[model samples]
Target: MDAASVPAPASPGPATAPPGDLAIWFFILAELLAFGVFFAAYAFARAHNVALFDTMQQTLDRQAGALNTVLLISGSACVARAVEAVGRARSATGARWLLAGIACGAGFLVVKGVEYAAKFEAGINLSTNTFYMFYLSLTFFHFMHVILGMVILVALWVKTRQGAYGPADMNGIESGAAYWHMVDLVWIVLFPLVYVMR
Candidate 1:
């Protein structure tokens, strides 16, 4: 068929990333690197003082950490569902899932705050010991990430309501979801490494 007679192709629906923005990926990579350095330092310190780590680990509130683990995982799952919903052009449904995710993340923050309050009440701080320095620092850092992720999700939720996300234009929502998953993953690793290790 002549070019004039042939029809142009239709683009595929659903976006996989921030279509035109490479900056977010760079930001994500930088964030991951910062966390990676922290984790590596933790491992090094743990290796040099296994006894200290074990004794301190025993003092952690495993129940709270465990609960937070479940909460973050559930939140991640909800975000995943939201991505799927958005993929199907179900913006409202996706926003609903994001709301659920925000709730889960909030639950995590509350539980974590309680845990921190108890620690503070008991006079715990970064100067308490090397283990606690790592504990408070790691967890609090992750806590901040959750807060930031929630903010992103909230923005995405607002955008979705404005019909900004869909299979054909998913970059913003997907990027936000990706960040949330990364936050969840870090907690998954942090919880076990800090709370349950012996």
Candidate 2:
């Protein structure tokens, strides 16, 4: 063998990091902190006005709340499956899972609309009392989050279809999923407090 035939060792430079993961984590942490404050306020108010809160809770339809809970929980499960599919290098499968998740979210919104209509017809507007005020405010805030989550899920589905998300670059999908889960988590607390914890 000639000296020219000897192979040179590869040199290393700065390592490249995955996109969006750190930013997503930071965003999630900030959102959690804000939600934590809201939850604390909710608990304080409920404790201070237990009798009124109980009266308000009694007016809500527990069955409807339970249905919404199941819907959100199913959506969260679909999101988890989508994450798994992405991890396994199945972008199409992940997209399908995302679509399912989005559908579940839409279903939750539809049910909520029915619940709201019933409440409105029953003279349970936001100004009715403190309980109704909290009910409208909290559920409306959550509904906004649901809309945002649906947008994110649709974006993720589109990206997945376009071959954007995969095992190597799934941070966006994961972040979106995490945000949806947070929304669901908030409702888990809110449903009981606003509708059942009398």
Candidate 3:
């Protein structure tokens, strides 16, 4: 066949990331740095005004914070199970795990919302004082991360339904799970600093 007369083979579809191999590390790193800065600020403020900070801590509901910490830690466990399910090529089971993790994360947020409402009603606005400012800023920023983690779980769940994850490749799921763990880790530090630092 003449070169000009021969048909060009169809171009391949856009390259896709292998399941669980998405470039998510950079995102996780950036998020960690941002939270780190917030943590540093919190530490500095607490160090400067130890008495006031302790007084502020006394006003918070440590029980609720501790319960939320448990929820997040449990959610991390579910994500681990989901990653295992993906490695076993059980996409449906993986989806179930991811969904359960997402539900736990949601529960954490709901509890946080209740805490916020209670604080708000008690006139614990950010403008109340430096300690309240740090408390609101740190917890609210953490809340935003929780929302992001939920979104990631939903995406992973959809990808699982689409059969994108399997035994051969579970990087996407693993990366998402790692990110969730980072969220949990941040809260672990935050809980002690904000609720138990007296």
Candidate 4:
């Protein structure tokens, strides 16, 4: 082998951190902790009121919960594709994917709104029962998160349309995406826990 013909070994690249700002990760951890506390409280309360919790869980519209699950999953997929597209410098395509994600998030809100309306119409409220109290509070908390996530998505879409995100510039969009994903992940757990757990 000719030494002159041999290529030098490639240098190792810088270590990659989690996508987005460190601040965003801290915020996400805080949000997760809050949700964890809520979940633990629900579990503790249910343990003592197993029969009421089980019966009230059955009264929940499982189909609506399932539909919202699909919507959140689909929205998360769209957001992931948008991030990929932006990484490739396909701003137009990225914006389109973000739009789709926003639509899915909107659909989730609409479905949940309908469910809430029905419950309200049937005279359900926080004072209705122990089950209703937790159900309303927990689901409403998650609903607010979804709203905030959608707002972030809309901002990301606008920036993407203006070509703000790319391989060299991903922090803003990535931070927003990370937050959106947290919202979806919480719902994924909530859906099964509140609707299906027996």
The best candidate by TM-score is: 4
- For each candidate in turn, give its C-alpha RMSD to the true structure in angstroms: 4.6, 6.8, 7.6, 5.7
When summed lDDT is taken over every stretch of 10 residues in candidate 4, the lowest stretch is 8-17
Residue 53, model 1: lDDT of: 93
Misplaced by over 4 Å in model 1 are 1-21
If both were scored by lDDT, which would come out higher, candidate 1 or candidate 4?
4
Q: Higher TM-score: candidate 2 or 4?
A: 4
Against the hidden reference, what TM-scores do the models get? 0.88, 0.86, 0.87, 0.93
lDDT tens digits by residue: candidate 1, 41-153: 99899999999999989888999999999999999999999999999999999999999999999999999999999999999999999999999998899999999999998
Least accurate stretch of 10 residues (summed lDDT) in model 1?
Answer: 13-22
lDDT of each: 0.88, 0.85, 0.89, 0.95
Report residue 127 deviation for candidate 3 (angstroms): 0.8
lDDT of 1: 0.88
Candidate 4 backbone collisions, by pair = none
The pairs that clash in candidate 3 are 20-171, 20-172, 21-172
Q: Candidate 2: which stretches are off by over 4 Å?
A: 1-20
